[model samples]
Target chain A: MWMGQSSVDFIMAGCKLLDEGNVQSFLDNTDIVLTDCDGVLWRGNQVIPGAQETIEKLRKLGKKVLFVTNNSTKTRAEYVTKCASLGFPASEDEIISSSYVTAHYLKYIVKYTGKVYTVGPQGLAQELNAVGIPNFGTGPDVAENWKFEDYTTLPLDPEVNCVVVGFDKDFSYVKLCRATAYLRDKGCLFVATNTDTGLPVNGRFIPGTGTIVAAVSEAAERRPDIICGKPHLPIFDTVLKLHNVDPKRCIMIGDRLNTDIELAHNCGLGAALLVLTGCATLEEVRQKQSSNSIADQRLVPNFYLPSLAQLGTLIDSLK
Target chain B: MWMGQSSVDFIMAGCKLLDEGNVQSFLDNTDIVLTDCDGVLWRGNQVIPGAQETIEKLRKLGKKVLFVTNNSTKTRAEYVTKCASLGFPASEDEIISSSYVTAHYLKYIVKYTGKVYTVGPQGLAQELNAVGIPNFGTGPDVAENWKFEDYTTLPLDPEVNCVVVGFDKDFSYVKLCRATAYLRDKGCLFVATNTDTGLPVNGRFIPGTGTIVAAVSEAAERRPDIICGKPHLPIFDTVLKLHNVDPKRCIMIGDRLNTDIELAHNCGLGAALLVLTGCATLEEVRQKQSSNSIADQRLVPNFYLPSLAQLGTLIDSLK
Candidate 1:
């Protein structure tokens, strides 16, 4: 269903289905594999069939595997525990979560010394704490029985020099007020973990970190100074700093094209593999393929598979 | 500081200082005056000097006076009370607040029948109640000790077919979750009162309705179907339906350039007068005047005074 010369060129360049003819060369050319967790490995609590076997087979082939997720609600330690529980055994070093990257960016990259006013969950705060960065504002900070006028008089911490926004279940008007107030200084750095708009749950959706970040950005009248997440440069910078891997030999496999596939494109990775088991569809890939916009074109993946199970089957046939 | 021929033409067409040579003609051409409340008449509780006298003089000169405000936290009746207390006595019919227009739009314009899930204050609900529209979700709706998982399971009102977002002091994550859920249905209408980012309070700022709207928009992955406030046509449409004043004979005066000045430009009003007592400054007007962008040019006002006090002085000289 490719349309023109441009579409044909894009199809030939990417979005090809992994087949017997291409599987051997694809594996031979890739040394590092960065796989997104939420949709690729599992949908919520249930793991995708053969995902564990595919990862195991990749590891047995001497391919370095890393669980790269934009989910900022969990620390690397927490992700490791979750990964083990889900049948994909992983260590802290192999988990490149957004929270870990944010902490690493702040601690090592920015070398920030002042206190951080975080509008996030406990795990996000834990990551900051682990990096020895003073932070607060995790739990409910709602203004109970207080008028809008009270919010103006609410005392702000003078020590706060940074505001980090992530997935916050306890997000409230008061926290938004405080975040805006701190950001008014202009010296205070505004950072966001990720901008995933919604999280799918039980076939439904709940507001994600993007929603919280949007709220703060609106109030602050500014976009985030830095975003330590997929599709952004900070997370990739962290990956490069921590691990030695050739960019042209790295493959990123994710179910979402905007975040995972775009991340691969942004980082100049060798390949982006789209799996039909999650948020994106083959129809979407075709739509992007025909679009003239470079931004939309970048969402097109280099490879496609029905699921990782199919990849596992392909590998078994080769053996 | 005008740059090119276009800049000179823009300045000659608008952004002229209201002086004795122009005051009489400007006043004679206007049959109705639409004035913004927050920045123009008063900043917080204290009123701008001579603002009340200026309104009284406008009325004595046989001009219809209407208080137009983007603040959606107050009903028209409540606005009347606020005006009376502030010495610029006004009737409920003279008050055209965003909340009033929102209710009017949903009630008469759209002829909406289903229950409205509101994320605003008591005054917003009062406005909807006055129009006999069933609404809920005003006060604090936080997820006390519950996790993010609980938000996905939170019961949604089946009757809710519309989500109205406005200035809410008790805005919380649970409220955002519900709003996002209701807006997920493509059939459900999404409405916002206004998108004022922050309210300047006691020299500081508190997050305004825009922050909440931004959050909900991000989560829902869609913009509001309609916004009933300044610079948008819905509120002006409400004004036209309620009053017999001609657009060419009506003038809008305010302190903000984006909302107040832009509204006058959008409505084909006779003149837009800028008063430097609140949000905007003379420097901003110059910036807009010099900009080549048509959108920026639209923000430039027809006449400007240091404050309403200067307009009062000009009128006294004429008498």
Candidate 2:
């Protein structure tokens, strides 16, 4: 009955725990499975237990599995190689990263042919290069002898029509000024890889792309035209268009409820499953469920599992 | 009649053009006068036309005058020297800069003796030193080769209980991460000098202190506890306390409506005058006067003057 309605009520009503009985039911209708890489597949360098087995089992079952990640530090090719090295059945075509999705969006959806003023890393540059998007303002640290007047006389390329922001170790005041100057022209497209407030670094979180993006936004006093990442429609649409996913037959699995689960709901996917291996816990899921507001209710996932390790056992039972 | 009322209506009603007849009447009761330095006194290194003469005339009339500025790049002694060089009579006691006010607020109002984590220039460090506030997190450039793991394990002083942000030419990701980490304690005091979005550089504007402040705020997901700059009460209260002036007998004059004129209204000053010599034009003041909304109406200055040069003539005619 709730199959056609694209409303919050329909999504909330379908949320429950994915059990052994429901695993077969979920797999029967869902042909495509999208899972987040970092928390779901691996925490850092180490892989999550039984997660690789579940991905391999899904591929063996003729399921079109794709790895969707918001970590824009690595290009799509890097993600593919990293995934394979970790013993997961992965390829370049099956990896959908924020940087890659951003490139795809700029090339296909917007039909943007102009040069990009990028404030990001080499990985972002590589992805843009793959799609034939020329970029400037990426490398080169701010000069030590930079005067206040130099910013006014900044030599900007006239062909640059887009300002892209992402995670860059070399992010500096020069890059910030150039991006802000390009964005001062209201017609120029403003795009950010992801607005993840913090990124995990050695078991602790530090400032992420959002912090960099926020500085430009505040200086310009304007919001980005689009953010090509999770919880936003551009990245989800990018994956859907590339893979030709059926909304009612696709499921999303991740560890965080806000980004992974909310992204699933926003894209009108079949279901979203939350695991306890990431930022969210069981107590948080329960708290979100008890909340009456529509926004809080949206954070509620369709299913809860202790870990993706349980999915490997369920898939094994099928054999 | 509306001497005690703090409503926006009273402030808006008190606005009028400073004419020959009103000049004497306005000055008769007003003994203390505050003014912004950049566009009002001088634009860059050159002083405004007749600005020095007007300051001299006011002093001759035995009126107390103070220069209120948000430029945190220079110390109070530097400002006094710069003012004298520009032919404007000024002293350290007659200057109120954002850095000085920030130091005063921490030392007097908050009574905070703990060390500070500063993301700003040497001017701020000097002010903090003057007040005997031990500080860290300034002057040093970001490491040449910083890894993500370094941020998680970055060396931080335990005594640092306050995070101060201002215009820093040496601002970097390392400084942003350290400030965010210090602020993660939740008990740490977060203070910003000013939120000027852009600073004028040879006619064009570049990113200012607000841009740097915003990045830390976004990463920490918390607003600064105190912003000791124009339109904020702390700086205004600092000047009033240091000079022991009456708000009912004080007046503010500047070239911008937002920071300068708004500061006057917020402080319950007797009058505010807008001069068409800076960022704002005459048309903007007219539009604000015609606006129906209370917020917009507050932007309308009580009086409009072509320039401070005209005030010098009016003062001479009286003699």
Candidate 3:
């Protein structure tokens, strides 16, 4: 019997390492694969060894593969191009970035007509623009020779009725002040792409979109109206609507537990497969499994692999 | 009977409005007056009516008056200048700003000798410099025409072992990145001036130090080790050590209940007097008084006045 159709007992007994004993059954149950891009497929400009082959093997086995990322720094088109260059060979339609969901949510779900003041990057802005939504405030907007008093008289666009926050290298105090001013209006919408605190790159960390969102939330004294990203319902809902995939037949494969694996549990996916090519370690999985908290237990993925290379080797052995 | 010497019965009966019947008794019990500037004394460049006269009257009655403010944008010297210009005529010793408390705590309490990475204005840096602490990261540290990839290679000061956050108009992504990197070390110290979300200025609001702190905290994945501002013990402890005033004889007066009034209650001061020339309103006081939570009830001041002008009139009438 496919694990997707099995009882809740299988999910409860999570954190089992995938090998010859169970790799075939895991693949048999998963008809659709939602894979996180960064740690699973690539780290910075370098692609993880055998990740490309694993994704290809999954696709060849008739599994519908989708590239899912909490990163809002890149648009779907940009992601597609990057994926191709990195050997993942993805199409724009096969990519579901946080930025894409943000734009989709605003355009289709909210049906917003007003201008947006975005505290993000060119990719986020491009996503919004692709959906025919008017937006501004992407790059550096720092005031020259500014005083604290200048903030009081800072001119705000009267047309902006929404504020979108994401990852922006040019995030500045001026942008924070502007966002707070717009968000002060009760009717104005506050949308965040994701709340991932830090982005890990080549063994280093940089402040992520969540840092910027935290600042804006503090100043506005309010949380985001909607967050369209992993471990949150909005992104999953978007995936469900766009792909029309059965949740029971889907497995989310990623490296991080809190975001990728927790998102799998939150969305009622068939199973979550954790790979050790990124942030999480087996020690952490063991800790989560031993923990009594249900929230922590949910972060325990159904299967673990040393890396995507192990999955590729297992698939080759299946032949 | 002096309410300061009275039992818990007097404190339970908080939110009493000051009038002719109660004003004299309230003052007689208060040996030291801790008054907040901005809304209580002045708003922007304009001083509150009768505020100067009220301070004069308090001093003439032999009360030791000190200016207590959560604002970290200005140092003690700047505050003294601002006070004299606004007719309050305060000396540097009477000025207790959050910036001053931050420097005091780091120099005297933590006894930290490491270079500080500050995310604040010149005044905050000046205060730290005054205490012989070497610091940097003031003004705009933004990367011109920067890409997200540049943040990965962003150089961090190896000598910086502490990150002090306050209000900074020049706050940018580069500063947030660098702060996060330095804070990754387990031995690094994280300190914040205050957590006031917004600074209400002439019917408008600007982001405060707390906003910046929130960003840094989110990125660093830790709360400040010490927040040297209102409602926290640091600033009040500084006051007690430097001035040697009994908490039971010190009354806190301010426009905001959350910071000033809550600080008084937290420190077990004689009383908290709300002057409604600033952010808070009587309606809010009533709400806090009616709240079931002890924390909410703590925000209820012992007394309230329409403004300091009423207190001045009451003093003249007594004379």
Candidate 4:
């Protein structure tokens, strides 16, 4: 079966059993591979067993690889350091993150010149600063208690014409006030890093960047002008442009159905392989695939394995 | 015509012109008058022109007057002090506020025994304390930067079974984490003061209590169980019970259609008179009334005037 052209409704019918022959055929048909970081590669800090070996083996087989992530809490340099320390060393150019993509979009695509009012952590600020984009409202607290006079004299920076929101731990009423006022002008561009409602940490989910973005959007009464994250095309388009890769020869491997699988679908990638190592459970995949509902079709994976390690073992046996 | 029973679609059709005859007729039909503080009586510290005189004249004409406010940043006592200093002296018992209503709900209605986790300022905490509801997570810097281990070690008060959200100047990431964790327990009650998206300050809008509430709600992935503000039954119920007034003889006067006028509509009050001083404009009101949408019906005021001063003039001439 030409699994790449098969509809999501036919995904279950075309499920390739991970025999050595099936694995070798799937591997030979792909030239470029994109992978998600947190779930498919590592749970929290520790890397998944054999995930590193599989990527390296893929590289040895002449396949191009890229690490695409939604975590905007760290700079690309920090991610590079983290990869190297975890025994999966990667170059800065090989990593595409929401934080990095936001900077890239602001600089190259939008050609923005004004200061950004960022409702995020220092990491996002550092990325913007690295691209020579001046930003405000990111660091330590400067907002005081609101008094009667504060109504007339709330501090505002007029130079801010862009507001970028991410996973902001330092989000305050003052920052919210400033961003809302700036957005009221409508000339200001509103951008968000990702829309992951909650993030997994230590086997549990906590509030994520999407929560912060939702708050700003609700208060401003305006949806984001651009959202650079999974299930969106900006980051994937950036990665494709940087690597100069053909979309038809690329496959995305991730553990999330909504973000990873749907991202590949949105980007016109060849296929998406779900590894049962993160948020989606096997029962959920079964429910989506067997259903005749067209809306649920987008969430069905092109292929799924019990774990990335199982795929790694299959590929190793082929070698 | 009895405007209280008039169709919302016919609100503008029955609107009283600011003539001596029309104004006198509107005054003659009401025994209790309820007014919003911020936009109707005053705009930030400076009382609106003729507002105080209008209230004094209403009282002289033997109308039972009460001040209703959504500002949860201060206690009823503080509001009394501010009102006294601003030329419109009001007693503590005559003022109904969101903070007061929230406290009353928790203490009397729910009879909550556990401590509260408050994501608000000193005023909300003080009101909760006055009602003997012990609360934590207010009025200081307790939340620190989240470390990786914070996922497991975030400080949480075991006794906190309710989370009250309002306009908190001291809100931070640590508080968000704590609240999210507490809410995940499922037994905890989530409450908010109001959901007004923004508040006008010195002719400009700033992010208000709704902004803060939205942030917490998004992060928690839960909606507030109780929102004790204008147009909501809790605050109005508290005011009605405290004053022992007849709803059918009451009239609500204010500038905002969505909040003040809707509050009267929701309470089954006798009439709603819109003043052209605050958020809603004539064009917007006319559009809402003219539309066939049922949702817009609650927002249409029974009558409208140029200002409270016009109503004051009508009453003085009657005297």
Off by over 4 Å in 1: A1-12, B1-12
* DockQ, each predicted model: 0.72, 0.69, 0.78, 0.52
What TM-score does each model's chain B reach against the true chain B?
0.95, 0.96, 0.95, 0.92
**CA shift at B74, candidate 1, in angstroms?**
1.5
lDDT of each: 0.88, 0.84, 0.88, 0.80
| Cα lDDT for residue B237, candidate 1 | 83
Q: Which stretches of candidate 3 lie over 4 Å from their true place?
A: A1-10, B1-10
The per-residue C-alpha lDDT of model 4 at residue A1 equals: 16
Residue-level lDDT of model 1, residues A125-181, one tens digit each, is 999999999999999897668866787787888899999998888899889998999
By lDDT, the better pick of 1 and 2 is 1
Give TM-scores of chain A for all candidates. Answer: 0.95, 0.95, 0.94, 0.92
TM-score of chain A of 1: 0.95
Better of 1 and 4 by TM-score: 1
Model 4 reproduces a share of the real contacts of 0.58
- Model 1 TM: 0.95
Winner on lDDT (3 vs 4): 3
